[model samples]
Target: MPDLPPIVDLRQSPTALRVQRGVMRFLRAAHGFSCFAEVSLANGRRADVLGIGPKGEIWIVEIKSSLTDYQVDRKWPEYKEFCDRFFFAKPPELDPDIFPPEEGLMVGDGHDAAILRMAPDGPLPPARRRAMLLKLARLGADRVHTLMDPGEPL
Candidate 1:
């Protein structure tokens, strides 16, 4: 048998992981979006949850595990430049009103989430949308290829 390279182990805080799961469940089960976690936007900021809908609309969700988490993350606003809609997903215990009124709200547990309000659409420019969709396709293909061939070079 040939020797194989070690697999990378991505770690996340338990709280963050739970929130991610909840956000993903909500995006998939409720919104019919295909989601990817920890996706890097062209601006170099990472989105906690990036969802692509059937009609090519892009949504970015910033997950806040605690009050402090929400307070300290100032870069979430920049995510709007890259996506059509933006939202904040947090534990059900947090008050949805605490977030910005113009943005969307989602309350989630470890398994699911409920949308308290709908996000307003801010459609992306055609060029940016095309670029983003290409990036997403490449990322998806890379992930699938890696799973199929563990030693494949990215």
Candidate 2:
């Protein structure tokens, strides 16, 4: 397979961007999951990283670059509706104890990450799952389309 092109995400902070990259890398390499970043959800909230496993299990990872970001953002709970599992990924130096125990946790650098605390399974409703599957498919297709033909509007 050809190597993926480097795409810069202007919306993320340096620390947040690193956390997002490492989380995406870990999901793909360790769990055979296809991941996308800055995903728009049904609830009007954007997800930091959204992934679908080989078995079609959906996961949403919320990245926290600093303690302030985590504390200021109370919308993470809303993300649970769109995924089978949810996680908070951050730099290894950050204290994991600040995160809620019910959700998953990950710690690493920009290179790679590990799922230090596994999240509980919260299966989505059948209708919602079907909708999200469609959303993911369309998002993936749009990305490919844009990557292949930059002049075309997605």
Candidate 3:
């Protein structure tokens, strides 16, 4: 058999992970979004950053570290069904104008971030809102439990 190429772990890369951290920090501090990183949705999609606001508003932010990252992703549209608002978060070096005008934009620098455009609200049905809320709560609790007891299974 032909030798296989070495596997690449994009999630562990410094740039991508740093962008996520900065986005998360900005969401939590500035936007009051108590978020869960890498949240799994009902449609078998994983959200990069899913946050729940005080008013139970669901907001999702998809991080794109570079132009290539943004261009390659086609799943972003699917996230809209699961949230009240959607946004794309990227490093300041990226051109925010490339993102869809209908969606929101945020720029990050591995420590802080700013929202360049606000996303329009598309309220979710009560049923979906309830389901998402429950899921977020469960995920958050699971993480806390895992932190408290490293050996525990989630």
Q: Which prediction has more favorable TM-score, 2 or 3?
A: 2
Per-residue lDDT of 8-54 in model 3, one digit per residue for the tens? Answer: 22554476677778888988898788977787788888888888888
lDDT of each: 0.81, 0.87, 0.82
Model 1 whole-model lDDT (C-alpha atoms): 0.81
Candidate 3 has a TM-score of 0.89
Model 2, residue 60: distance off in Å is: 0.3
Compare the candidates by lDDT and give the number of the best one.
Answer: 2
Cα lDDT for residue 120, model 3? Answer: 91
**Model 2 clash pairs?**
none
Q: Tens digit of lDDT per residue, candidate 1, span 107-148?
A: 777898878777899999999999999999998877666667
Ranking by TM-score: 2, 3, 1
Clash count, one per candidate: 0, 0, 0
Clashing pairs in 1: none
